[model samples]
Target: MVVLNAVIEAAGLEKTYPARDRGGTPFRAVAGIGLRVERGEAFGFLGPNGAGKSSTMRMLGGVSAPTAGTLRILGLDPAAHGRRVRARLGVVPQDDSLDVHLTVRENLLVYGRYFGLSRKAVRERAGELLEFARLTEKADERVEHLSGGMRRRLTIARALINDPEILLLDEPTTGLDPQARHVLWDRLFRLKQDGVTLILTTHYMDEAEQLCDRLVIMDKGLIADEGSPRELIERHITREVLELRFPPGEHEQVAVKLGRDGLPEPERLEVLPDRLLWYAEDGETALARATAAGVQPITALVRRATLEDVFLRLTGRSLTD
Candidate 1:
């Protein structure tokens, strides 16, 4: 069955910023991108810096107008009905924009008031959100006193003041420690369990794999590939990869001899500054053959291919590069 109930829809969506100087061409931040967010699916955009993920998010949030395309949020034209569309969305920006001077509870209450909510209703919701964010004990504390993760959670909580149907989180856990990131991820997981449609943008491979049900890998304002994490890995790369590290200056020499008849014949071979990677169905066999061909490595490891490999294979570059 072809389901058509989408929380956000865009076709040939584009955005261009005005030229920095006169007679210069405008910058195309987004170029003819199309996407659909299902009612309850966690959709994500995975990309490095300058990939236009944030631009697209702003358009969908009803804050930016498309240059030459269509965008509908909650089944309304965002260009014309942006205010109405924004009422149904909760947005967490890349940076935590909490008011440091305001108490945690006060921040939430203030945000709720902007949505035209009654003071009584806002206070009730703020109490619930404080518990949801695990900041009940810090409810009356100044936001400046909170940790990075706590402030992030509070920002997310403030976004939920109107009980939005769709939530947009941009790099939600960028600067947190591992434990704090996990806590935030758990909260997002719970929101997904409650059937809140989530749309997020991130450069972290594991984060995307862990959170997104499906995602698009974007590069230079265009989508390079789209699929679930496992699906992208299975489709774009071998099942396993063998990493071989020889002496620093010897990688080039090894690369010349790799994937030849006398040595390991892998599906693909990549030579980085520090290591040689062999991609194949069986990493052990590839390593064994390479060793037999007079290839001695200082270190060798065989691990299953992941979304990072898929990203590299598709973009001809690492995710961070």
Candidate 2:
């Protein structure tokens, strides 16, 4: 690992919440996970709902202490120095926990005071953050009067009140519209360019591809894989994948016949209810050979392999699944 002043480091980090029922085993939200994030890198935890992404993020945010293992953020132990750690870290939660009664700028000013900023200082920072979130026009509007996207942006701007060194985002774009998500992405890109270390959790493959410098894919409370999006895709799958769709019932039958022919057999073949994915170094070659053998697909498409394919290959389930 090319360590450029590691800002976040963990060894066997774990978290467990109390069981809901009496005598039941405690719920293990985050199983042992080891990670290292260098300064100024946009790191991410990519996973589906209930895959321990939130639990792990909570631990990193210093709001919840880990049950076991070790963690260090900015060279300080989060479990021990949570207050100091939080002072230098921004957090945009999955939910927009804005005070409905407060104006866009008032909310930020209030949060900034938690870090002990003077009223005048808080006001100044709130002004800058309002501009950053593109909420200058709505600065005096009550949060309840703002649109969903505007509220989300305000939440992010509020988290920056302390001028934190690192930012933690949990499913930042979960409910936003496409335009809102893109807008958030652009803001996050600027933060990355400004040398602020960021850690975010997301189930969106494209989001990870666009924003993360490095990431870990979590599943069932465990680290399934870790790498840059392209690195993970290349490591776990072929360069190209051919998607062949037929009538619902014919997938298994054709899949059997395709492999039986031994005509440049697919490097990997995935049989799905509606389609068959053929992995190959060259998708065109695979498609032509299949066509020559009278294995006609109702519809065929060839595309580059993606992180989504890597997830499916690793967990036997896609993000939606």
Candidate 3:
């Protein structure tokens, strides 16, 4: 049974794929994991490639069956009642699977018909969705002629044809220009305000930080951690980070030098190829202390800790595919 007020629930979810080669072990895409998403809140699965995010999303959307687990969408078992569950869920896949031959309005209308709506009803909803997607003026334009952002919006509009209670977005803003991304974000934000539950999967740290009320960090088919963006940062990282860039190929050496040279022991020190991140409550003070210890770098910067730091701390890797 679904938990009270939970739109989606999973326990020990697992998905495995047959190996390409004969006599090889099966590939386990999703390890045992559990999560619950309540109504009207935006939840996210944040991870890089091969992190099982897409596999988990496919199961949640009823597109794939879990190998071993209990899964529910809207209080119904997806495996037992896929049609019923899917009817109330909108899916915006990573690819905008819009029909290039169809006009923008036609796309929505056709998709609505698939849900068994009356022709008249579908047309009316299509018009409203076109406006919601900011594509009303382009309603008559064929999708092939529209810009990338417009096509993405049309895809979203089509998914809403059934008035689903939950919407699943997979990398919603990938490949869009910044301006287009912001416009799409505004539309999604409005949906949140209107009490639509959102489940999204993305590798973009900034996107997760901006949109997710709570998120899970997944890696290697397992979840590393879960929490609200700010909570994760506060829990796993310091308040501020001082980035020090040393000479070429010296970042590793500087990581050791900073601590030994009287730099106030930071909460943590992360050494990357490009820079050394000194995690501390007081970034400026750390910088001053480092300077006093006679350490000089090519460049220095101080910035607030973020979700990326939390992911890095948990998974020991960047959130890039």
Candidate 4:
């Protein structure tokens, strides 16, 4: 059965921005991107800087119009029904844009009002949201006084003021401590359990793997690949990965030897300044066979393949540069 529960849909969605130079032609930020985010799925955009993630996000949020293509949010055209579509969506931008002058509670109160929420309802929701965000104790405190993580949590609370059906988060945990990041993750997980649709953009592979049910990897305004983390890894890479580090200047010689042996030829091999990675199935078995063949590596570690491995295989480089 082709059950349809998509809340966000895009087809050939494209966006272009004027180049910095006055005489330069416009630049394409998003090119022929097609996506469909289901009602309860946590979808993710995985890419490096300048990968059109933010541009695509803006169009989805109804803040930027596409130069060419179509987008529908909540079954309404984002370009024509922006106000109606925006009312049902929440956005947490990459940069924190909270009103620093207002107290934490006041920030939520004001944002709720923007959605035409009744004052009494806004107040009640503010208290609930503060507890949800774990900022109840800081409700009266100025945003400037809160930690980066606290601010991020508050931003999430503000985004949810209207009980939005879809939430959009752009790098929600950037620059946060481990403890804070986990706290945010826990909150997001709760929302996921409540059946709220989430779309997030992140440079962190672990973040995408942890939270996203499915994701798309974007590179230079194009999608390199799209699938669940496991699907992408299974399709593009092997089950396990082996890392080998050799004292500089010996990798090429070692690589040649390992390639000549009967180990499954790695789907991808990365030569870094300090280490080399071999992507293949059964990393431990591969390592054993390589070692038995006298392919001596300074250090060897076998680990599960990750979304990073899939991305590097598809894009020919690391997501973080």
Model 3 poorest 10 in a row by lDDT: 257-266
Model 4 spans > 4 angstroms off: 1-3, 260-268
> Candidate 1 lDDT, tens digit per residue, 237-269?
889999999988888888777643344333888
* Model 2 clashing residue pairs (backbone): none
Q: Which 10 successive residues of model 1 have the least lDDT summed? A: 257-266
Question: All models: lDDT?
Answer: 0.90, 0.91, 0.90, 0.90
- TM-score per prediction, in order, is 0.95, 0.96, 0.96, 0.96
Q: Model 3, range 217-293, lDDT digits (tens) per residue?
A: 99988989889999999888999999998888988777777774554544778887778889999999889977987
- Give the distance in Å from residue 22's predicted Cα in candidate 2 to where it truly belongs: 1.4
lDDT of 2: 0.91
The true-versus-predicted C-alpha distance at residue 21 of model 2, in Å, is 2.1
Model 3 lDDT at residue 143: 94
lDDT of 4 by residue, 98-171 (tens): 99999999999999999999999999999999999999999999999999999999999999999999999999
Query: Which residue pairs show backbone clashes in model 4?
Result: none
